[model samples]
Target: MESYFRYDRMMPREYQRRIAENVIAKGNSLVILPTGLGKTAIALLVADKYLREGKRVLFLAPTKPLCEQHRKSFEELMKLEKGDVVLITGELNAEKRRGMWEAGRVIVATPQCVKNDLKKERMRLNFGLVVLDEVHRAVGNYAYTFVAEECRRSGLHLLGLTASPGSSKEKIEKMSELLGVKNIEIREETDEDVRKYVQPIEIRWETVEFPSEMDEIRKLLEQMIEERMEVLRKFEWIKAKNFRSLSKRVLMQVRERIERSSGGVKWMGLSQHAALMNLLHAHELLETQGASTFAEFFGRMEAKEKKSKAVMRILKDGRVKLALEKASQLKVDHPKLEKLRQIIETGKGKMYIVFVQYRDQVKKVVEELNKIPGVRAERFVGKREGVTQEEQKRTIERFRNGEFNVLVASSIGEEGLDIPAVDCVIFYEPIPSEIRNIQRRGRTARTRPGEVIILITKNTRDEAYYWVARSRERKMKRVVRGMQKMLQDRRKGAQSKLTEFV
Candidate 1:
């Protein structure tokens, strides 16, 4: 095997080297390696090819901490001097960054900042390569898309990296297209090259009851959701067989569809759509999440300033009122909480990361976990929730230092935050998104054998969502592999035509 980098110690494994060579050969590749399988190492090897050519490189991560992480990894592994790698942040003046752009061999920054710099003409695409850390987000109007367009415009080689690039085929294809990815590389844990490096992850589930009273509330909310849907269906606005089968993704379109409608039907459908969303949310909270979360949802809606007619209609519903009273009358929290506490108490792991979907549940989980003796847990959330980046970094550092044995985080923890040495991952509730499921599972079993325990409430979306995500994960791997094959065939076809012409 040809050695790609002479930066001193630390060489890539056979699989990493092969992938890196493939990426270098393919030009503008999207790498879908599982988390912790050394995607950065592959990038480092590829970057060496560019750096040796005396060209600059740009690494784009979604967040500042991630940017710092990639920069540190390149510096340490490549044995680069401190001045060689630049960490660009908004804190620095544009002129300072402009100077660093030319001065540094490698630059790392958030996509938003990079896009602004590119727009201001302060940064040039003179680099040999650009690496987008979470490239699955390269769709739509995200900053990643803008930077990717610039790379294509400059005819610069670019690499997009992500562990789980979503399960939707259209979304994946769009991401590949927008990023100008000519080749898609996906490696499964079952692959012979990858299986040896990945440890076994045992997955199991603990079931909790959907308390009878809570079931009553869920039924009430479901009735409301179905009623709205039924009316919309009569109006030919929705065509779902049942509300239970309808997804939030589908329901979200109703608002836009309503807006495009004319006359009295527009406001009518809009009101119904809004009510359906609110009812569905309340039902999900009561069924899948805890009562306190449900109450919080209701409270937030009530607290909204200048409520819309739809909101007022939902607030005035007798069923909604009765359900709220019933939830308040109940003394116990979501059964999943007690189940989670029990699992943490008896779990064999030294450190646990609990993934919850709701911010209310994140705080609730932390409060519940800390109640256990000898358990130190902290809530990890996003800036929108009032937690600053400094606080987030400090919380992660504290967790890493073992000051906290458990980190109860929302969706923010699902991605590439690098919470190390996690022995187990617990899902506070099952989510239907396959990307999140894979990301959450990747939290554990990176370096050591670990287990994942899912808390499921029987006869609810919790169980249904678990199945949906698992099925979609399997389908996602197939989708990405299909994309890879498609690209390969197209390349081959192009080559054959060129040979014929010759």
Candidate 2:
């Protein structure tokens, strides 16, 4: 017989009901559910159980906006008084927050605020349960670690939630250890129980060929990178046989080696490698992003006062200058831009969110999108982009109300935001992280069927990134499955031990 609890508060789907029951029984759990699949619903169910027992619950999110968002959801779903569910953020003064902490039964706060409060002794770590949203960030010196440690010390029930933990096994292990996760519940979009609630997402890939002019500039940049690599080879700073085959990871390793070395030779090698990496990044931007992005980057480099001879050498090169000029005078927009325009055109009365990797692209994309009649577009960026939290809130509200048919956003739009379902999602370019790729795609196909269009530039870094994200997503699923299996086996072993004792 299937048992359900808290159905009166928020009617959860079958999978959510099962997962919540399991998590509540296990206590310390890491729940990995896809976006729009009701991870928050599970948290609410568990929170209700804790609240009924006259125990306080603390929900931690990564950002203030997410904290505020969760607060609203809790207020709406949970059968609690408006004052019982309180939001604590940096905006609140210490005294005011302390009062709220004492008064509120369910608290939604940014982890940093919780960490600060814990440090100041303004807030007690006596909660019966702590929910960490975006728990993949639990690793390292993030506030999630501090809060989790405090929770463990106080013997509080912990529930960590994320759409994607990460692709690396080491990162997953570290995050699990930090949260003291005793069980992991992972469900993919294709899971049998999950399929009913998952609206179908049609993923389309559109490939564009680089223009001949862009190719010429690419070759020039590659040549410059080769020259720098040659200098590094003379010093034996790098042992790679083919510079073209070298990856960003390999270059990062080289950087670590340079950091550890000493003397003038090390300094020279560092300067050369730095210049090479910059030029390579520029090459990638031109090939994958757009000439405008490449031009802006090169212009910044050119305008910045040079500190190293190697930087001066690359900036002063005739080929570099030629590439910059060519990029500035490009006769056409990037091919991806045209395809994006086409995708939007076909989706006429529908809403869309276009995800770009850079802030500058957000402006450029919004500008290009606004050129089309009936296409109202706006840029959504982070606080660093001069967008205040209030401004972000307003933008999302307007986007939700259909004041804008399209939202051109940076990576900020990818995680934990309450974005409305759209008819389509357009990836300005393929990202290399499976986590981001999943988040971007999660923005649509939420309430109904939706489409995803990925713009990939053939024979460029875009193609490579597309494959990298795909491969990582596959690996991540396998890793999550293994973790789930291990947790199940552990539970069974403990059960067997109890039976033997009986």
**Clash pairs for candidate 2:** none
What is model 1's C-alpha RMSD?
2.1
Query: What global local distance difference test value does model 2 have?
Result: 0.86
Model 1, stretches more than 4 Å misplaced? 1-9, 496-502
Error of 1 at 81 (Å): 2.9
Residues 1-502 of candidate 2: C-alpha lDDT, one tens digit per residue: 1222335666789998899899988869999999999899899888878877888899999999899889888877876776988889999898888878888888899989889988999988768899999998888898888888989878888999999988999889888887788989999888999998899999989988888767888888888888888887877778887665677778998888887888987787788888988888888788877788988887787788755676688778999899888888888768888888888887789999999997777898899889888899999999898889899989999999999999999999999988898889999988889899889999999889999999888887788888889999999988888988998899899999999999
TM-score of each: 0.95, 0.95
Give model 1's clash tally: 0
lDDT of 1 by residue, 341-424 (tens): 888888634799899998878877788788888888888999889988888888888988888789888998988886775998
